[model samples]
Target chain A: MLPSSTSDKVFRSTLFVLGGSYVLLVVLLLVADLAYSSWGQLAELLGKPEIVHAIWLTLGTCTAAAVLSMLVAVPLGFVLARYRFRLKWLVDALVEIPVVLPPLVVGLSLLILFHLPVNGVKLEDWLRSNLGWSVTYAVPAVVLAQFAVAGAFAVRTMRVTFDQIHPRAELVALTLGCSQAQAFWRVALPQAWRGMIAAFTIAWARSLGEFGPILVFAGATRMRTEVLSTTVFLELSVGNLESAVAVSLLMVAVALVVLLVLRGLGVERRA
Target chain B: MIELKNISIVSGSFALRDVSLSLQHGEYVALMGRTGQGKTTILEAIAGLRMVTSGDILMDGRNVTRLAPAERGVGYVPQDLALFPTMTVRENVGFALKVRGVAKAERDARVHDVAEWLGISRLLDRRVTMLSGGEAQRTALGRALSFKPKVLLLDEPFSALDDETRQEMHALMVSVRTHTGVTVLHVTHNRAEATALADRVIQLEAGAIQ
Candidate 1:
């Protein structure tokens, strides 16, 4: 009433509610999960061989997927950030297809992709026939699905990181007798190292959280292909809510640690 | 000698059109222009960082227009100094030699010698991010001169320094030219810098060299 229809307190309260609601919801979700699962019950669930296997498998596969994502993303990010070329807009959009696509459909696409006959041979069939390895409903499939989605996120992160850096340093390095490759390795890559770690952690966190694609592409085989996300699903499908929540909490913990490490890297603040 | 024969470069909104200039061996020349008048763009074209729409760049009568920046062996210090922030002063100074696969002992010796020459020997182990403006300028100069390149291009190297620091840098710059006898192309809009450091001054008006 003093100077406006909405009082300062009212405006401030509305703003806090709009923003804090999401924060509150997140806290409530974590709290509810923690409240539902007893420490002893979490320990008992961890004691299960299947759950233990899922834990190891989740850690291993997510790490592998994140590493794979990084390998593809770093170079992709560098090129996309540094160059101008034909169809660049199309290429940029194509890289983000998986990020926007329905995750389950991505899994389905991978499944069909393997079945596609190229040179009159299905890739999945070819692998099974020639290499004595099965990708579908297998361990490799889980990593692939995770990499497909997480790599997109990693690529985006790497691109932003590279964009934040000025190209002058690399130009100077080139003038100082460094080839393009040498400048990238010595100057550009070193400067982007913190951002690279942030990208990796983001990828790893994303890979850990990946569910739909893994379930569709890899099929939830008990000990062989069950990651923690899939483990949560398997537990919940059988009415084991406590176990599911505990595993979800475990994921939350791991993701929180990875994110904390990312914050420590301070790439975002610089950007 | 460094020669740009009617080179036209388009960089974003700035176009350096049909600008031609030459710096003879051991010549200390100042290229003066206002901001966004493509002063830095000229430095870049000579450094092989920017493409020329037409004409050619020559170093010692060798056509270097198509040559890569590394192949040209240009010593470029951008206005920002662009010192590799992640590295210590020692590493930054020795970067060219290291990339050229110079042996460890020789690289270290060269870096030490350059650092000492630039009065940065004591600062060698310190991170570049920890350096003051003048200290950073010296570090950058050390890095550029370390490889003994035939030509040195400086883009507004003193633009960020205070008057005292700028004067000191001008003195150091003259010492550098005298000691190395490298052809210098110092770009700046500051008349004082040109008067203090240059043997000849080339004016860049609009986008063309006059």
Candidate 2:
């Protein structure tokens, strides 16, 4: 052999190129699919009522679920971050289970358990009767399915956020005569806003990508529970590959916009 | 005056054994110890930030061991000098006054006065993140004093400052003690800080006072 150092350098360079090429290949495939199929057709399909309605419903359900998730996740994150309770790690692990669990498994599980009648009352029926909520195969069900998955994302991120904030600020506020609530609001909330916003964006994106749960629990009826991802599935099932690609392209666009906006916000906040 | 009667706080891996300390009005007592030698634990116990396992805390001779931090009237500036970095200097200074439901005009005037007294009047509009370490410490000090607390507990207020700033902070502490007549219990591992500002310096080793 040649010089050992030169061989080591060649080996590292080869590995680096291999890894980078793999990543580039995946990106190229995605671009090719979008470009060859639906990227040019988007302007024509932009006026389609069914597509428009699905987009609106997707945005609406995702927005509602994201908001509700934040409301629950923020407080839950605080409890998880600030307090040491029995089985706290178990609770944290349970929160993260959604990220690893197959979305289809989550959907099927919810359907099997909640869709069935419990003591002469179907869970969906009971919700409608008692809580005035129309559950499965409706907007509420779609949101619930999204919340179950996206809420976990918010909780995980928000928990880290709260952990990063120094409790001393809250204590200082308390010493100054602020009630604990006031301290949390005036001190902790402002400091944690960036992380909260980031968590919210991630949660919203998760809700947007939600398909299996929404499909199984909410039923992707045309123009009804048909969110963007669900629309792609429906289109694909019907051999409408162009429409499916169109919906996928739309989703990619939405995701790009969300990430860009969040990045800008993150930079602005830091400045 | 503030007093700790046999305060014993035991956090996992650290315990503050039967410790007692007192400060009369206008007196500044410095608690000097090495890091992790229970300096902070003692201050925290006095501030009600941590629960005393089997002892009592008294503020102005009132038993406040079980009272929440807000009700204790014991202003505490922790070691990190935890200022709300998102808030402006004026907002941070007025925090306690606002919490007490002081009127807007009164809170503003008090904030202005404390900001001026601490020589941070020019920094009132600056964010805590933008302030120097010395400036941030002063902002924390000003915030604590704004409440006109019955006592002040500073956990190494000048530890983060450079020599010049530390000297100025020592002067500021003296002025604060003179003006408010508030009893103070300051915890610092620095001998210089203790010797500079303390009316009495209490040394500790392990959990007990040496």
Best by lDDT: 1
Best by DockQ: 1
lDDT of 1 at B60: 98
lDDT of each: 0.90, 0.86
Per-residue lDDT for A1-271 in model 1, tens only? 3565558878888999999999999999999999988889878987999988988888899999999999999999999999999999998999999999999999999999999999899999989999999999999999999999999999999999899999889989888888888889988998898778888988898899899999999999899999999988998999988888999998888778767867876755455
> Which sections of candidate 1 miss by over 4 Å?
A1-21, A257-271, B11-14
lDDT of 1 by residue, B97-173 (tens): 98889999999999988887789999999999999999999999999999999899999888899999988888898
Residues A51-122, candidate 2: write the lDDT tens digits.
898989988998999999999899999889888899998998999898899998888888887778778888
Considering only N, C-alpha and C atoms within 3 Å, which residue pairs clash in candidate 2?
A: A176-B96
lDDT of 2 at A127: 80
Per-prediction CA RMSD (Å)? 3.6, 3.6
Instruction: Point out the worst 10-residue segment of candidate 1 chain B by lDDT.
Output: B10-19
Runs in model 2 deviating more than 4 A are A1-26, A38-40
| DockQ of each candidate, alpha-carbon based | 0.79, 0.75
